[model samples]
Target chain A: MPLIKGDQITEDPWVYADDEDELPSGDVVVHLERWEKDKDSLRSRNGKLGLILRSDQSPELVADDLAAFDLIALDFPAFKDGRAFSYARMLRERFAFEGEIRAVGDVHRDQLFFMHRCGFDAFEVENAAVLQDWLEAAREFTSVYQPALDAKQSVLRLRHHTKKAAE
Target chain B: MYRYDEFDRTIVDERVKQFRGQVARRVSGDLTEEQFRPLRLMNGLYLQLHAYMLRVAVPYGTLSSKQMRMLAHIARKYDKGYGHFTTRQNIQYNWPKLEEVPDLLADLATVEMHAIQTSGNCIRNVTSDQYAGVAAGEIEDPRVYCEIIRQWSTFHPEFSFLPRKFKIAVTASEDDRAAIRVHDIGIQLVKNAAGETGFRFFVGGGLGRTPVVGPEINSFVKKKDLLSYLEAILRVYNQLGRRDNLYKARIKILVRSVGTGEFAEMVDKEWQFIKDGKYDLPQDEIDRIKAYFAPPAYETLPATDATLKDKIEANADFAAWVKRNVAEHKVPGYGIVNISLKPIGGIPGDATAEQMEVVADLAEKYSFDEVRVTHEQNLVLPDVKKSDLFVVWEALSASDMGTSNLGTITDMISCPGLDYCNLANARSIPVAQRISERFADLSRQHDIGDLKVKISGCINACGHHHVGNIGILGVDKKGQEFYQITLGGSATEDASIGKILGPAFSYDEIVDAVEKVVDVYLEHRAPGEAFLGLVDRVGLDPFKEKLYAAH
Candidate 1:
């Protein structure tokens, strides 16, 4: 698997850990259940922690503990189930999580742009050969209509600015 | 009409470029049909039963003459020289090759139109009353808010993929011409006791498999909180709506399962977090959009045109046409003229390229360079003057666009069923044509008066059979086509789902069955009572007895 960040495919330092398997040493990502059950022991580990929330889980469940993790990964069980799009926005715009937001599971070239717009900075794609295609997908549109976590100025704001400048 | 600004133009141009690349990839076999389906659908291209069908959205049913001419161009160059105006205020070209769609879309973009969100499971084109700015006694122009929503929902990141396709309709007049009550989300503009204009929201109304009139969720959401409120509702639906079953994915099912009271509570809780945030519409932004929809320039003239009166009296045909096809305009000398696409025994909603060019010419010359596509599959010259009525009729008649049956029994709302739709189980257009031929006499149609006959090929109800006064659903009974009838339905302010009347009628029997139902209404109706009113006063018993007694 390859990870896309910004305009390039970068080396992924984080490793996903299964619940029954032994925890990896550094920069480990665990599921929500594992993180909730072993909170005390995981906090004592010598690594940066990350949490993966499923499509059915909301970001509000970990609102108070958002500062504990260096990354939050949202899962799309299927590409058509889009609950995680809203969850990614809530993690950035509402809870103000500044860590890495990763999109995992069923990530494809078609959805990379929307996932990027919804504040997903990293995507764990299945095929390493299509990394360049995924990167291009994430930059498909030069402008957008609605404001999201990205810094791109919305068209509405641009229209108002243009009118004001002419005035 | 709202003209595209610089930002709007840039976005549509980029969209066309992006889709061109996507179509290239699909042609080279780099992308499979499974992967390319949603991408093409998002741009409003569908692979129908015959060839590719391209649905071009007419935003809020408003069209400039230049845009109408462009539609005529597309029809002449790409399709089979015709287009179908749909129930959702869209125009669908029934035949276009896969390779030619990118060029077709580029042509549309040049006219400030693209087929965005017309077929995808995203927020569809926002619809409003066909008579939006010109309708008398409207609280405020609904197109202003409809355009606002159009900008906000176009390529919205968080809601591009939801549980199912979403539709939103807005209306400001007391008369619900836009059919707001049966949409996924219906917004009615209202003035409060303190004389403040706001929105009355209706959530989860739909007309598919299980038809339900959306219940009122909030009485009045202030003007500033409109976008925030809609975002809240979408957030709730995206998070909790069912995705496991395609039939149960609409918002109406979600509202029914959790109950409207509980659904509203969930939306209110979501609104608490983002109500007054950056999504709240600023007064300046609203004003900017509002400026585009200001009243067109008009010369002062008397209310009644004496020459028009004399023409109507001297010519009985013109009088009949005016009586059925014209509506009062807010401006004194202007009239809203409805040009029926349903000629006697012809296909409903099908307009030829020449007819489209004729309408474009008429709009440019007589009606402030504007036209409207009504939800009833008709075209509207929204601001024709009373004095120009005879000439407009003459032009339309020359083009074969004048049927003079605006709301009569023959002006039906039908779908491109088994003839062109893969999802259909039986044919719909042929049945509609038969019924139209049976009631081709204009005098008899006017005498019967204001009966809506909607037909669908399947239970998906794209034809809105559930809301028709006389609803007909075509079913496939063991590989044979059969039609089922329902009675006592209305899509107005007093909206209700029709109840099924008795058994199904075969292909040979459906037209006779419809005639019998109409005959029963004509035989036992109070004077001046509409078909829907008659159905409301007397239930389906009389219709059922006449329809089934011969067995």
Candidate 2:
């Protein structure tokens, strides 16, 4: 899977660990259930811990242990499922998670812009061929109307700033 | 009437470019239809039964004469030389090709217009009272807040892919002209006891398979906290709204499931964090948008013009039209004229490019170069002089646009049913036409008086049948089209969902059935009583007995 960070498609550093698999030594992204069940063991391990939340799972459940995870990956499940977008924002804004948040599963070039706005710093898209497309899509719009976790200068702010400057 | 500043221009231009690329990818097979559906929908493009239908947003239903001409141009150049104005105060072109949509969007961008969020799960166009600024008894123009919501909701990253589509409507008038009660989120501007302007929030009111009247969640949210409150409500809905069932995905269902009190509590909890945060809109920004909707320059003329009275006395036709189609404006010497799109026995709300040009020309000449599209699927010249009534009527009458039946039975709100919509169960236009033809007599229509007969092709209530005084819902009964009737519903200060009247009627019997209901109302009505008022005093039993007597 290609992981896009900002304008670059850097290699994914975190290894995704599935159920029934032995824990990896380096930074590993585990399923939410697995992390919940073995949080102590996972934290005790020398490897960095990360949690991958399903679309239905609330980030509030894991907000207390948000600092334990080096990265958080949100599963889209489907392109139309937007729960991940809200989850990503909650982890960043409410949980005050400072680690990397990656979008996984059904991540497409079209959703890159919105996903980026919701505080996803990295993307784990299934297709590597559209890396350039993803990069372009991330920076497609010059202005945003809403204030998001990305803290991009909203159009209202820009206009207010311009008027104040003129004054 | 708001012109795009440089930042607005850049945003709209970028959206066009983005949509252009998305369309290219879809054409080149890079993106599948499933992937492209939302992208296209966000741009207000839909693949219907025949061709692509592009819904162009007339922001808060306000339009300049120039924008109206551009719509006419698009109708003539791209698709068929006609367009249908919707009940949401937007216009829809039925026959545009997918290949030409990008160009169409680009053209719209030129006039500070784009089809963004007209469809899709995102927040749709923020509709408002058509007579916002000009309407009598308005506290303030609702379009200022509507434009604020429009900006905040447009391309909202966290909300663009919600469980289902969202609709928001704002109204400043005490008389609910915008039908705020049946929207996903309805904001009514109110003055507090302290004379401070505040917002009253109504969450989760919608009409579809399940019709719900949104309850007032917060009676008073300070003007500054409006956006924050909205964000909180949306965040709660986004996380918890039912996504498993397509039919139950709207916020109305969630609000109903958890009860309005619980939902309000949840939203209030979420709002605590957002109320004074960065989401609180600045007073200067509100002032900025408010300036765009300021009352237009008007000549200082007498409240009543002698020439208009003389013309009315001289010409009976002009007098009748003035009584029906013209409304009292807030400004002196000015009258708001509703140009009837529901010409007798014509497709309701359908206007040809030539007619649009005529209206545009009329707006520029008679009105102050401003026009409004009413949710009743009609056009309004909001600043017409009382003196120009005769000339305006004459010009409109020449183009077969003057029907002199505003708020009459013939002035029906009918959705583009099976004729254009893929989701339609039966035809709505034909049924509306039959009803219109049945009540064709002008005197009879006027005598009947102020009756709203809304027809919907399906239960989606796009025609807003649920709130009409007399509601008609088209149903498919084992592949055969059947029309169901409902009575006593209203979209007003006293808003109520219409009650279902017995069994469904065949398409042929529906018109007569409607006539019988009207005749019953006429017979039972007391002196100076309206149809709805009669229904209110004397219940649906009278009309139902008359309607289903033979059956």
Candidate 3:
């Protein structure tokens, strides 16, 4: 899998361990059930820690434990299933989770812009062919209407300032 | 007539660019059709039965003359010299090629219009009363809030891909001209006990395979918390709405499964977390948007126009048109003129490019450059002066746009059935045409007054047959086409889904069946009683007895 971060394709150092698989040594991401079952063991292990949540899994389940992990990967069971988009926004704006929110599973170039705006900073796509398109798609819109987790100024705020300046 | 500011202009231009790239990728085979369907639908492009149909959003049913002219241009250049004004108050061009859609969208964006969210499983184009600002005794103008919701829902990241499509409608008057009760989320502008204006919300009302009138979720929400509350409802639906079954995907189903009380509680709980956050609308923005909808300039004049009265006395045809098609305006000496698209024995909502150009000319000259599209598939000049009524009627009559059936039997709403839609089971336009021809006599139509006959080609109810006083739904029995009739549905403030009559009527018998139902109503009704009132007085038993007697 290739990872899209910012405008470039970068090496992904995180290893995804299946639910029944043995934990890898360095910077390993485990499923929610695995992390829940072996919380103490994984917490005491070496290297950085990460957790993966399925589309059905709510971020509120791990709200208290967000500080323990360095990354939270949200799964898009299907591109059409937009639960993770809400989960990502909740993690960033509601729970105030500062960890890296990565989007995995069925991620594509067309949805990358929306995914990024929903607070997913990194995406794991199936192919490297989509990296350039992903970069362009993420920067497709120069202005947006509503406030999101991203730091971009909304058009409403801009209009407010413009009104003040004219006054 | 809200002009696009720089921010609005930039967002629309960028969206066009983005869609152009998507279309290029699709055409070059980089993206497959399965992957491109949702993308195209989100931009209001649908692969219909014959060709690509492009639905252009007429925000809250409001249009300027410039925009109307551009629509005529698109109709002539891209489609078959005509366009269909839909029940959602939008216009659809039924025959544009896939590759030409980007340029069509570009042309639309130049005039501050686009087809964004006219389809797809996202928050669709916000609809409102066609008589929004001009209607007498309106609590407040609903377009300001509609514009607010439009901007908020456009490209919203969190809830773009929900379980199913969402629709929202707004109205500012007690008369529910916008049909808010059948929408997913209906907002009514009302005054609270303190004499302050706010919104009363109805959640999860829709007409589809399953028809349910949305229940009022809140009596009154403060002005500032409107978006926050809407966000709360969308978040709850996006997270919990059923996605496994396409038929059960609408918010109406979720609201039904959990009951309105529980659903309202869930929304309230969700709102507790985000109500005071960034989603709370600022007062300044509301004021700014409201400024665009302020009352236009007018000279002091009497309530009645002497020239109009004399002309009405001189010409019986003009008098009939005035009596049927004109509505009272809040301002004195002004009238709200309804332009009926359902001409005698013609396609119900179809308007030719010539008609569009004529309407644009009339709107520019007489109506202060504003036009409106109604959910009933009609057009309105919302601010026509009484003095200019004769001239406007003459111009419209010249273009074959004049009709004296505003709310009569011939003012029927029929969807583009098997003729254009792949989802239709039977042809609806022919049946509507037959019904119109049967009731072609204006005197007879006036006798059976204020009858709404809505026809849907299928159970999806795009023509809003579920809420029509006389509803017709087309079905396929084995290989042949059949029509099912429902009576006693009303889409006004008192909303209810129609009841189905006993059996199905074949293609040939459906029009006669409708006539029989009307005959029953006319015979049994007291003087001046409308169809729905008669049906309410005497339930479906009388209609069923009459309709099934021959069987």
Candidate 4:
């Protein structure tokens, strides 16, 4: 299967020590928006568990009824449509569910960093130029912000509070 | 009045470049009106009835003297020598060329201001009580939280494309001058069982075709969870809100349909994920943003000045103006001064270039270089010393900004209805002028005591007519300008939508219709009962009986 995620494109993707922790399929069959209508019915299907439903389909609803799935795809639909971004943020900050969140469909190359900050672990680009753009966009803006997921604690807040950093 | 750091400056500069490119693309043949519409709207540019209008965000309606001067400069250079202050703590330039907007945005950025998110379906300018930092009644200035929300919502990655435009108003006092009851998210600062500072949130309140006084969603939302809860509400709206019909797109429709309790449950379920995230009230960030709005170095002075008393007694007009327009300040020597943008029968909230210059000069001379624009369509000198009241009065009178009507029936909040707005069904300015002229007598208005007259041209309720004590909605009946009059509506602590009084009235007959109701109130009111109180006591039947009884 064609994949945009996992370091298999660049490095060893599956770090699992044993084979039982990994799937037997050589290629993962990804989920699409049409399957979102019958996601509950498809969760029990044989080969369908390889991919996850997109974030645009109410991330909260998906979290509440998270039928055991390995990967979830967060689709941007367009660069301006932001519900998917908020969806990723909720998944990381609120749900506390540790899993691979993949960015897919309509996801632009420039928004990869923000997608990562919101908690997407992997990305699906439209083209090869977009792949390079995604890597560059992810590294350009360096300063941390307040609304970001806790990749780093708020140093500004800590500095202002006690007037000294804790040892 | 937050200062712009390098980060703020960079973001705004980049945004200006983006908007300029978008404008070029639209003008050239690269983009169509349908495609370019949202992009232009995000930048606060609108294609109105006559021209392109640019709305500049005056965050929480506060401006420094330098910023006020920049606005005056923009008004003279780009617009028709005037600016219109809006209810949501922003200013609108009615006559701006589409090509010259980028330059205007660049100028505004110099004053630490920009038009970002002023018009789009994003979180609009977070509004608060105009008397936030200096009011006698406010507890721990509402501008503090307003600033916090501003920083958090600025280029917020998640909530940019909401279902409909969102407005959030905060008020510390139980007496809400911010009209918090009529916003999408109305947050009142309240004390919990432990007497700690927190928020009481009300959701789904708004003023449009469907007027809803927001229902209480949270009794005590901790201060730290403000951003998380707001995210949850927006998430709920973005996900479940109606995209099929434009009229039903507002969150109020969703709340009314699904019920506020269910909506709150949905938000709570979403909030469970983010409340513990990194977006909390880290004391440092709050202090950093709060330092910008902290009170200025004020000199200790007497509360009442003998010199001012002499000036007031010498000129009866000046005394009436001082008593009516100025409000008590939290500090002993200072006061909040209100300069009327409405002069007699002139358009409400319209300040010409000369008037803006005078206001800027007064700000520089009287209370330092700080200024504020009140939601009441008036300019506010928020830190004026009580001793300088007479001088302000003189300067305002000379520039025709010294109309001594604040909160009276004559100080109506009116939009540029059919005169300029493409959406208005009927003309509103003419009706406001007629009503102002009718009640030109100061003594009559003083007797009327604290009545709000809000007029909207169409059902979109841009003028906020639904909450006015005397609400006038203009409509076209067979192409004739007829106004539907409503009574007992208000935007205060006791807020309610006005009740329609029978059939509509002709343009000429509307003034008579209002006068007849006032006459009825004057006849039936007990001692000290205002128009609203009288309506509550005698009911709409009395007013309805008089409107069509003998006519």
Candidate 5:
């Protein structure tokens, strides 16, 4: 099933009609009403293990609360905020979370490589065709630097040390 | 003067090949500007306002006559027949196409030169006393340690990505000619109480929009622990420095935000783990590096140059050049010659391809073919046989490369500024040109001797304005460019940041204001006192009183 929109099944054993706006795909429905995204909801919620979080909320707090989740949806209210990049890296390197970190809004193909290097795995791009452009980011540079999210060397450190016999 | 062994030569050659590939890839669209930016910068290729500029490193500012001639030839052929020697002891060709850089690097490689780490957020070209081994001052040779640091820092795995670029300078003499205090990491080579050679470490010294004097982190760093202490500092900075804002990412900012005391503590903690680690310098390695800098054979001769003295006394121009450009050497009758890149009205660090070739040839003939780039953006032919000084000076004079404004007011450290740098607001070279013209009289320059004037186009102190005895910083109000003047800045052992006189001035008024500052110093100062010494005792009050008292 597509992670963006797949099904809406209630516990009443009834299948509801899907809305025009695709409902995010998940087996569990986490109703994180405004202020209720506390540690309890984070720790107790048990389903497809995908929970969406607001951008305004502290990703650091959410990262600490998160134990085992398959997907993290970090919302983007406006395009310019770069708090998410740090949050993603913090989750990936700091918290050692090995799950899909998705960037949901105000993102384009140009920010894909830097975004991915900062540890955003899958981009919730605007259109399906945008995915192709996002892939172009990987082709931009032949090497990586400083062991980013991708296991590679930084351009500055990309000196291919010619091998010599070890002492 | 470090000789390139087979390994070093191979490494430099391989570097050229890699940079060539990178250039080709960039031209073929395999690498975009963003992708190619770091690569080109690491190779010392910068695309400025007018065209591309290539900065060729002069390790410890040492070069030979053959190398100098090669530089001159390259300048005449590839560039605008001139090259600018930078404040960091390197020569820059102001115009070259991106495609031509590979061949340039290859040509330089033949002469044992490369521009590795001249830019980017890595440990930049290590600088030291331009008159390193030849200076009369006693202690140790600064280049030996500089070379050690070069080998250790080159492509160090953990330091490739830092918050910002780093610069390290060392000085061995009592006089701080290398401006060690103005570097990111400055080392003062000294022997300890027990007669053990070591270094005094200074961290966080830098000049930019925010000028700072580095603090002495360690009273003394054992010679063997130089690389480890540096690693500790870099580790602390890399992990903790602010990466969120580019402007505040420099180690200077980290040193500021963390508080030097706390930062020192952090570095101490890190040093505990790596203080005696793998990168320690051994006697063999030190000897190896020292072998590269071992002075050429010298022949003792008379100390007094009666003939040269007579010539200078007869010709006022030669006198002026000799008074400013000649430095004391340890050997009898030998002098270290500083080749002035700043001619009367020429661009400060610009050297022509032909001029480079000429310098190379001169190095081979007169000097030991080893040339050094001064931190003041001048070239030095260290270890010139005093007997051959007359001949070298004549050759230099014919080429107009013999301005002799070595420590004078006209030997300006100027940034590319608005003419080239993307970060600058006003043009620096034109102001520098006007000042040079104003001070063109050789007699007048001598009369007002031993002054350091530095100019920067913007707040980014690429010109190192904070250390200039007379400093000029250009700023923009609304959209128009205006220049500010400061006095009493010194970069020696008693380093202090320059103080602004008052309000900013029009471009035309700025030069006159500088003239006024000098005139004030000339009027009130006692005999034989240098500008910096005079500025120290009286403070900036006399100059400031006269300066701001203007309309």
Candidate 6:
């Protein structure tokens, strides 16, 4: 129930609304089925609504509802199931969703660096004891080579930039 | 030959530290084995049958003398004083303590090497033609693109955890030495109508339970768009590749289901968005990487050296070795020398630390200080001068490295089956040794020229048995080990999977059956026809009859 947002752990404000429970105040996260069923009622409430997507679920299906949510958390289910990493990137890069993208369920310290690079700014880690480990994991590598939604300057770009500066 | 810059060094060092911490956590009970398996696998470590095995990536099969010595050092210190070269052009140390892996990786990082992506479900070590830079008539150096792909695929955020492991092979020559047809994604550097170099893409080619040669997806993609196109393909596979069934998880399965035409269209449509985007490789970066692979310094000499001729004439063994182990290099007076790891009855790719150090010394002295690991599980000194071949031969002969069995029946590609691999159903090394001893005589092996007998302990095809000229696959028959034979498979330019030759034979009868098949080939062949050529000329019926005659 801990949320990591850009090197800092903060209290998770988003509450999951179960099928039988009423929608909570402030920001609330619900599954796709719940969002589909209570879209009108959730919009009429005073709080913003977000949807939790499984690895099998596609963000393209909810492209029209991007503007209505403050968070879109992609579920990993297992760390080996990497479909959410792609989903996060697709949400940010393709669908152009500008919200707090989070990684949920079975997130490990080893994957936080890549999770951030894939456009997931927030992580829902189960154990708060390993929060420091997770923060250190995000800074494991000083440079990367590939272009991603995170837009960190790559080593190749840095090399060229340094060479040009010297020139 | 690609030297690691400051950035490269830092990345590898950071990875080593991260893995070190992870290993410490795993050993101290902070992480469960299930939680640590993927992490260790990403660093190329696997818990085998007896002990932990660490697979070190020999990227593109290219290595410098310093790097080779480092591998040898790791073998001597961390392992059982020897390492097994895999069919993927990587090396595996069968015995290494889990705690010592970080230190081992740190030593590897000193030489700009790490084992990342060697065993994970990520894009595995990008393989290329073993003789990439020196091979004659190559369109361009394939390692350039292989290096590009290596960078793009390393720790890639989106495609790192794919449905299954992915493999990519690249070849710049007209003859596909890298087995471009049987990979998940194969790239052939070709010239288009405008006389500019581009890539011909092949998707869905793999060998396993179902062996299929990948079909061509795009005839030609421009050079500038290689990364974008490849990213498109990976994006499509990551989103739609089968996640429900492990057996049908490779991109090849997806390509088969969707059809190559439809897959190609999807890739093309995906390519539209990213074709001109940030992944487009810049010319300066390409030039920077290309500079690392420029031709090594060479002395000006005649095409054929007289000293080599004189030495060969004097020593009959040297002459025989020259006929088999030496290949033509692009540079005048230089030859590509294949040092056979398949000595008469030895393991296919096992090299002791002493033997490795000897090769490193020989490479430093004779071959421009460089070595290469071939997918055929042999070592290569790619720039040996023809005049220096005799000395190289003598040094190698001292260590039993010069067997004069390159590309012969004895020079087999074998996987570490049940002997070390936990996934194997039957043992593969003893069978390979039996076959090698059965055909040990140098003259006899030469007489049966260019016969590749690849053996795998299981159907995973780690030994590449599906593409061997005389393929032998180890199968378990009700707790007994039996072998299935496939004929006419060639991993060369004319890549084709061999057809099964009747029922499986017991281990005792497998070698004799192979001998019978060879006898049939020897009896019914035209002049200048190799074993593969002979099988092509005549169908598999004759060999099948001879093999299945008694049983």
Q: Tell me the whole-model lDDT of each prediction, alpha carbons only.
A: 0.92, 0.90, 0.92, 0.78, 0.74, 0.90
Compute the TM-score of each model's chain A versus the native chain A and list the values: 0.95, 0.94, 0.95, 0.66, 0.67, 0.92
Stretches > 4 Å off in candidate 6: A19-26, A36-45
Sequence-dependent TM-score of model 2: 0.98
DockQ (Cα-based) for each candidate:
0.79, 0.85, 0.83, 0.27, 0.06, 0.73
TM-score of 3: 0.98
Task: Give the worst 10-residue stretch by lDDT in candidate 4 chain B.
Answer: B277-286
Candidate 2 local lDDT, residue B422:
97
B386-460, model 2: which lDDT tens digit per residue?
989888989999998998999999999999999989999999999988888888899888888899999999998
Tens digits of per-residue lDDT for model 3 on A62-132?
Answer: 88888889999998888889889889988988888888999999887878888888999998988888677
Clashes of each: 0, 0, 0, 1, 56, 1
What digit string (tens of lDDT, one per residue) describes model 6 on residues B1-551?
A: 79988888888899998999999999999889998999998889999999999999999999989999999999999988999998889999999999899999999999989999999888999888888989999999999989888888888878889888999999999988899899999999999888999999999999987888999999999877888899899988988898888889999999999999999999998789778888788777888999998888889979999999899889999999999999999999999999999999899999999999999999999998989999999999999999899999999999999999999999999999999999888889999999999998899988878899999999988888999998999999999999999998988889999988889989999999999988998899887798888888888989877777666
Query: In candidate 6, residue B529 scores what lDDT?
Result: 90
Once fitted onto the true fold, the runs of candidate 2 whose alpha carbons sit more than 4 angstroms away are none
Q: List the residue pairs that clash in candidate 1.
A: none
Top DockQ: which candidate number? 2
- Per-residue lDDT, model 1, residue B492, is 86
lDDT of 1 by residue, B84-115 (tens): 99999999999999899999999999999999
Please identify which of the two predictions, 3 or 4, would achieve the higher TM-score against the true structure.
Answer: 3
Clashing pairs in 2: none
Candidate 2, residue A78: Cα displacement in angstroms equals 1.0
- Classify candidate 5 by CAPRI docking class: incorrect
The CAPRI-style docking tier of model 1 reads: medium
User: Which run of 10 residues does model 1 chain B get worst, by summed lDDT?
Assistant: B277-286
For model 6, state the Cα shift of residue B355 in Å: 1.0
DockQ of candidate 6 against the true complex: 0.73
